[model samples]
Target: MSGEPEPGLVPEHQRPRHDECESVLLTVDGEQFRVCAQAGRPGAYDFDWLSGPHEYGFGLTNSGGLALSRDELVQAIREFLAEIDPATGYLAE
Candidate 1:
């Protein structure tokens, strides 16, 4: 796959309901963090470990989790990364 960086940290403004397939690599603490976007239906989507050795994950939703949105997912990723153990190297100085 191309090493080219993906779009900005912001999620796409007008993405299709079933066409979320963006992937990006994030460098943290000298390690590469790979984040991929998937399509979620009206309900919850099953969590799967497609690639990498990420052993931690966090799930966040709307005020009531009425439905999962791209923005919410991105926010969750940011929060999760913030809570990673410093020794794990998932976090940087």
Candidate 2:
């Protein structure tokens, strides 16, 4: 899907004003996922993943309070996807 965020996944009014926000589309096992991160207060990141009508998200912070690189985010997404239960399409408990 050109690896671009789907139009309207994030509303314009809710988007961060800064240019630090980054987003991309990824497909895994034929499922399309939208991943996004915005630099938050103190340089940490608020990130989320959206697939169809479901979304999972969290904040991320480190001692250094640096933003995660795109590659790093992608790796993290892969790990997150690995934990999803195929039967329910949600993270396994």
Which structure among the candidates has the greatest lDDT? Answer: 2
The residue-level lDDT of candidate 1 at 57 comes to 34
What's the lDDT for candidate 1? 0.37
For 1-93, candidate 1 gives per-residue lDDT tens digits of: 111112222233433233364444454434444344444433232222123244333222233325445554444444445555657524333
Model 1 Cα shift for residue 53 (angstroms): 3.9
Total clashes in model 2, counting residue pairs 3 or more apart in sequence or in different chains = 0
Give the true-structure RMSD of model 1. 12.1
**Which of the numbered candidates is closest to the native, going by highest TM-score?**
2
Q: Rate the local accuracy (lDDT) of all candidates.
A: 0.37, 0.51
* Runs with alpha carbons beyond 4 Å of true place in candidate 1: 1-52, 61-65, 89-93
Clashing pairs in 2: none
Q: How displaced is residue 22 in candidate 2, in Å?
A: 4.9
Each candidate's root-mean-square deviation in Å?
A: 12.1, 8.1
Backbone N/Cα/C clashes per model:
0, 0
Q: Estimate the TM-score of every prediction.
A: 0.36, 0.53
* Alpha-carbon shift of residue 26 in model 1 (angstroms): 11
